[model samples]
Target: MRNLASLLLLFLVLLAAGPLQAAPRRDFANQYQPRRTVEVDTRREGDSLRVYLRFPNRIAQRRRVPLRVMGWIDFDARRPLWQDTVRGAARRLRPDGDVDRLSFALPISRLVSGHALSVAFGDAEDAMGGDAAWLRLTPENLNRSFIFIDSLSRPLMRRYVRAREVFGVDAYAPGQTLNAYRYPLSSLAAAPPMATSNTLGQQPRTLGLQDSARFNADQLLRLPAGLYLLRLGNRGPSQGLLVEENRFPQLTSADELIAPLIYVSTSEERQKLFDAPDPKKAVDYFWLGVASDDQDKARQLIRQFYGRVVVANTIFSAHKAGWLTDRGMLYQILGAPETVYRSGNEERWVYRGYQSLNTIFVFRAKPSIFAPDNYELVRRPEHEFLWYAAVELWRKGLIAQPGR
Candidate 1:
């Protein structure tokens, strides 16, 4: 039995170290997977952290399965530095149509400083089922000074504000003057540099300031569509926010609908779609072709594809729209990974592969002055075949639908 256990451990280590294929497995990193039970958002407020948990309304409305909320602070990813149970927090559910949200204020002032804070919610029976979030925390993160959209009631986890929504500034030290600046969204959409490759010290493209404003705690802000930065003063740390038209991450316009098709459409095909007089109709026609004139199949394909577009925008968005980012492209085409592992500055997404092999994609954190959650994919020559193959599977309606 001892020899058998040792061999099994060795096999597991080998699987993790290379591109070996295997069945879907569970890990401690469900935070990176598409959530099914709840969505978590956290922010720093002085010496305290504010956490918001949002779950499907049915979970509360049914009341069949008891729910639990738990959290902890950790220095290394392996062990908890501090842990807490939100006693009876699940009983206080504020319903909002399809979802319900609960808020908690965790005072971390007395606890030892930690690098990451995690909160998880789900079934009381299993103690874990809903969703979890692992947020990077520090002594002086930008969450100290951020804008709150007064007109929006949902969690501000995505840092997205609709154009023309009313917003108010919040700072650790109240009544301080805040400087807000806006910049045009960058126009580049290429695969990120590989792990083995170097950026050649290349800098992100320069963006010109489009607008600026001054405000205080008592002031209200409303801006046109662009990228906005909120800071304490001209030289303070800035919190990046995205101002989008329509409900963001949702495809409502022709441009939003057409942009995500780049992965599957040929150059000529994409140009025609863009040049078409009726873009919505063109998009529908394209999907219909992929579905082979089957209306139901076409509908399912469209729903799954664009559904991922919305989720990509929600979870992976940083400087640009999520569906346009490297991870976004992969998520849109391939759906969620079977397993996700994270470290200080990198993430590894593993998926079941063809034949007897498994596939792994690594993303390195490339935080910039403008986008803190920014990550670049470790691009490779071999990945081109995987990408094209997945695109073909999508076009052929052969890919499984769900968890998009």
Candidate 2:
């Protein structure tokens, strides 16, 4: 940790060189989509924020394509507290067909509570593609005890570990007993068409008992597909460290493929899918119908719809599969919002050019024992018309690529 923190001095050298050009602050929808060029993750360790950048095989294979990375502490969406650029070539590049990663740490000793670490990716040629991602952090969460993947030194920002993977719970209060409670993986029900309440209430879900363990420095154990709660003691306010175990966000299981169809399919169509003998065939046939029996169009609809499903799993998976969440429902149907603005504990997603009066959707951050970063959508009756229209586009196989 000390060595990583020391690397922050490199930012000073960048400052002495000259004032680097700044990219435009434009669309931020790409931040929520599946990154095609690279994947990024961050974790706060003591006074340092460790950042990891993973480049896909395709990006790594293009040796001539120069890639640049820049980062800053975003206290608000409008301005930056501190900013610096890092050279991608400074790190060794991997060959094609292999995943390559570049990692560095930034000191956060001066930061106190609320701030987002924003990182932007671009190249020397165009440089105006202001695509960036952010990691929201607080001092308390960093210092407190948390869980992380045993194989990796960072926190589980990906929100999942492969089935049967071993992970460890780092206890802040040593020698005290920490109990682990496991909750079965439950799929979210269909999002209602109208707003019923201001805030969605969370009910106590079924929890299965797991082996009790002492609060050692780190307790490492293997787990199946479920949500695990690590609390300091046996009784509390139901608040604790929640860890979800699953495979990558890709939809592989039959149930996984069938559940998200609720947004695009009618009740009868969904019933047929659920009762079908072969799930894969049923899914293919449903998409075929949506494409009006056109094989090529059917393939496109499948890719686009399921691609958003994969991205939803990447972005919104928390206490449940992201596809089943309220935000996931709109994301899959409407594609990425035209604009996303984040304020204190709430995010407003704006989509322009719609025929309805409602263009912005507000999601309030509702943290729970199972989902620490969970955000619930504020549903409304006015959303019914827009929701059906968007769903109609998907059914007709006319939806464009997200963030287009």
Candidate 3:
């Protein structure tokens, strides 16, 4: 009787411990899988506008996965806003789900003066989860503010101009009515058509102009050189007008206008920039930012940086490739470690500077078809640049070191 009781107690304890171990392992697996980041670019066509969302190859998998997209357009006060879903490509999840690429497109009619468009992605269903990421589309006459939504209804994640160094634009009409349009000349398929008025309102009739009277450059150029909304009237239905100035232009050159305003807003770019080179660029680009019009220069930068990442991978890669993993490449660029530790599948990289600003890069190794060893950087501390800046500041005697 005594032996039986002891055996039963041991079995129960083992059963309890089993889940404790398994739970963390499962959670770690999910947390480690790389989350996809999206990039959006818009251009105008004849009567329609084409919006393209580019996904990095690192985010796509081998199993069929659906991406849900949603969009909303607000034209004017008189007409109701337009809202609908825009489905994205059905991507396949790779065995590891760590490195895949995919993209989607949405098309709509020409945007009039006062219209604003918003778009986002839906949550993933299965083992993966999806969070809404959005882009707000504004006409050329309005301030070139790109609103990036990390969470809908929540405060904006980033609101700024596009990176002009990477994108270029040509403005036709200089000062008259600010007909300045900015597009990433390198990435755009072709020039988009220009529209005169806002056409997204629920009641298209609100714009008293004849349906056939499309807005021409002459009409658009005539408006006072300021930000204007292409809606109905400024007042009530009785006072139906064609155009109304709402926002002002931020700058003279549309490219200069939108550059700093729009940002990548994700650490993925930095991570990929580290791993993306065929043979990473030298440390030169890291110390020297990328040039605007030089692809060869960018490629050279990648090669240089990637070379060091390869070294880090050779020295640090445990179950995964060093350049492919977070800590490996980060440590390579960041130089010798101040401290290093691991929690489950995640390896944290700590760099101590003037202040205790620690940058954490969380990584996970997952099964994938591309390679036997796959790893991803899942999380990074916010405002990491400040830490690097702090380091520089300390070196320059601009700031005191921590615990000094």
lDDT (Cα, tens digit) per residue for candidate 2, span 1-404: 87766676677777888888775444456557565435555545556655666655445545444444333343235545555555554454443246555566666574445666555344432222334445556543444344354555434445565566766654434465656566666655646647465434564465566544445435666665666666656652233333343455777777677878887778898888889999879999988888889999999888888898888777777677777787787788888777776676777788877653448888888876566667888888888788777777887777743343
| Model 3 lDDT tens row, 1-404 | 99999999999998987755321111121111123334444434334454544343444333344455433242112222444544545532222233333333345443444344433333422212212233334443122212122212111111121222111121122222212321111111101111112421232222222222223222312322211223212221110011111221112232321221112113453454445443134223432344333556545544444444444433333322333244443433444444434333444444565255655444565422212234455543453564355435422323222221
Q: What is the TM-score of candidate 1?
A: 0.78
Give the better candidate number (1 or 3) by TM-score.
1
Off by over 4 Å in 3: 1-36, 72-88, 91-133, 141-404
Q: Which residue runs of candidate 1 sit more than 4 Å off their true CA positions? A: 1-38, 42-44, 58-76, 87-93, 108-114, 121-130, 139-143, 152-155, 172-174, 190-205, 235-237, 354-356, 400-404
Using lDDT as the yardstick, the better of models 1 and 3 is: 1
If both were scored by TM-score, which would come out higher, candidate 2 or candidate 3? 2
lDDT of 1 by residue, 241-333 (tens): 778888786889887888788777777888888899998899999999999999999998999999988988887766778887888877787
The lDDT for every candidate, in the order shown, is 0.67, 0.62, 0.33
TM-score of each: 0.78, 0.71, 0.26
Enumerate residue pairs that collide in model 2.
195-379, 195-380
Better of 1 and 2 by TM-score: 1
